[model samples]
Target: MHHTARKFSLSVTAILASLLVTLSPHTFAAVGSLDLTTSGIGYFSLVLFVIAYLLVMGEELLHLRKSKPVLVAAGIIWMLLGWVYTQEGMPHEAEHAFRHTLLEFAELMLFLLVAMTYINAMDERNVFDALRAWMIRKGFNYKTLFWLTGFLAFFISPIADNLTTALLMCAVIMKVGGEDKKFINICCINVVVAANAGGAFSPFGDITTLMVWQAGIIPFQDFFALFIPSLVNFGVPAVIMSFFIENKKPDALDEAVEMKRGAMRILALFLLTIVTAVSCHTFLHLPPVLGMMTGLGYLQFFGFFLRKTLPGSLARKRAIAESRGDQAALRRLGDVVPFDVFSKIARSEWDTLLFFYGVVMCVGGLGFMGYLALMSEVLYTGMGATVTNIILGVVSAVIDNIPVMFAVLTMQPDMSTGDWLLITLTAGVGGSMLSIGSAAGVALMGQARGMYTFIGHLKWAPVIALGYAASIAVHLWINADLFVK
Candidate 1:
């Protein structure tokens, strides 16, 4: 099934490329050197983009990877734009724009790769498993665990991505809640809300915020101004739902787990890496990825140290086992183990990286064709920034926030810093309104399966909506000075 889908995507992309090539010269110069936005090719490009996004939205039902269709769409869209630019004697314009978008994706991809490697390394060393075991051993009642998990998700997501934070918290929910579906369902909702809300205030917290930060529209420290509003967004929904959780204790099993050697060091290295990335961007004025790549070197050297010492450590253990005449222990020590940093890199999320590539290129292509300018005129200029930004938050609840945020950035509307921050907060937290809205919410649905279904999340939409509105109101009131300038 997967192979067939791959072939279909490739075939569609090839057909589109060929069709563009075969179009009459008249179609290329339809308006006699007019703007591409009003030309025949522009309309065709829009149709192609719409079809590609429809496929992206239907990924769950279609049983196809979301990246495949968008990858194909991006290629075809750019190919057509390239042809038009070449015909107009401005090929460099197209080439430069394409390269610029690729650069953006490159920085994002490398930054995420280093972060994911550290996360994978920590996971492999039983760091997360140990944390899970500790929580379970606490044997807290359902209500206490509910608040505890929710608050943890809220705080942890600012450091880790919201998706990862949600997955970890969900694991605790499933383990502790056991067969009590109600406890599991409500807790999952709280995690999603808290994670999304927590991510809104930090550039590292969400992809949308990262983009805004990279674009130089907002400074790093200014993001913290949203901290109060973000808390309100998460706390409102959590306080309302806390009443629904039954006061009961889950059955506990005693399981003691220890983190493998170097787990703590790797975690510390990750924190240092984040600081390096921020410092490089803020002080050195270098691309943050440069610092991230440097941090990757730190891991590589530490991994080498662990590998170099393994045999000596294993030999000493084997010697002790032999003296005790414990044959099983001696045999187990015979297998030497070493940490390999490359393995962690290899385990990073390639699908997500590629999806980002497609989104950036496809949106760049549309912006080049003048669609985004038209959108800016209608949405930002016509509707005004404040109203348009609020509507965008609601729209994000239906569509994925990545594309919506990307398209807005491409528009480059003239708005105040407060407006920029408002959009950032909305785009990040708005996904909490629907299970399918944000990556964290979608992942939790899969992790929790039947207990956290779309309908189940939808039933609480009104309550979540309340938090959403409350957040916006608080932002407008508390940060009123930002808008004045």
Candidate 2:
């Protein structure tokens, strides 16, 4: 199935590439440099933005040929090259600047690769399944468990990431929560909302925050000043969502019999992966991807250890062996691995990752188009830095926040400590506005299905919008004069 998907993707890419080549010179040459003073850069920007979004959406929504989107990327690149030339047009004095862009792009590519590998490796170890079962065993009744899972996804995402955290929580929800789909939906929504919200206030959380911090648009550690506001954004909705849920009592717990203590030991492995990645980023100034790849390399050693000793699995087996009544036929199914598990985990929603890559690269291409450069100069330079921060937050809610954050990072405006805090608050929490507004929100829909549907999220849009306002208000109230001088 994966190979088939790959083939289809390639085929689609070919068709898109052909169309771009045929359409390129005319469409792109005519585009020239867009002037916001006229029909507005927003128009051209929207065109570029929608095309990129269509490629992603088409890839997800339609089952076409293999490598289909790869071709689309080529055509878009053709358009981008023309726009880049017309807009930025080199330094004019024959200077070499491509090196810098490529360097930045490489770092991002690495980050994506490492993140993917780490997630796959962790799943191979069944770490997430263990975590969910433990939660169920702890007697966290439905409501508490619901909130607890989301809160964990929230905090863990800052370190683990929104996609990885959401995917992991989904497995647990599927296993213990039964076939009632709404449970999956609700759990997913809360998890994503919390994840992005928690991620907003931390430099370590979310790729977008890292991009902004790395560019020095915001100082490290100052992001937490937005924490109170960030909490308001997440806390308000979570409270509202809770009011709608039917709370039920938890099953009683027996004695504190541990689920293999060794499962906890894997936390050390997880830490090692993170530490390795961070060190590479800090010490060598390498892209986060290299670190993730290095961690993937380390997980191979972990696999050897797993083969040597199965911890929780062995005990669970022994107890099954001890049971006398209906042992024979049931034991076979229980002990043997289900093919469904293989397909589910193997077919984990990976297109989302590729979609992210395309969206970012296109956004980078749009940045090449110069209107963004103009925005920095006119809007940012004229309005003063604080309003720029607010505009950026609003922009993120309407567009893919990642690129907006990236553009803000690339521009590298001189901002007050308080102003920087506002960027953190909005870019992180602002994405809750539409389902596609944030990665966590988007992934939750795919991972959990009906619960976090776009309309469902849209229903809460007004509330999240209010939360967005409240969060900014909190930031201004708390950090007001730091904005002044």
Best by TM-score: 1
Write one digit per residue (lDDT tens) for candidate 2, span 193-291: 777787777655665666655543454456667678777877877887787666765464442222332344455665777677667656786544466
Model 1 TM-score, all chains together: 0.89
Question: To one decimal, what is the Cα RMSD in angstroms of model 1 from the true structure?
Answer: 7.1
Full-model lDDT for every candidate = 0.77, 0.57
> Model 1: how far is 103 from its true place, Å?
2.3
What's model 1's lDDT at 385?
Answer: 94
Task: Tell me how many residue pairs clash in candidate 1.
Answer: 0
TM-score of each: 0.89, 0.70
TM-score of 2: 0.70
Worst 10 residues of 2 by lDDT: 20-29
Backbone clash pairs for candidate 1 read none
Which parts of model 1 are misplaced by more than 4 Å? 1-34, 315-336
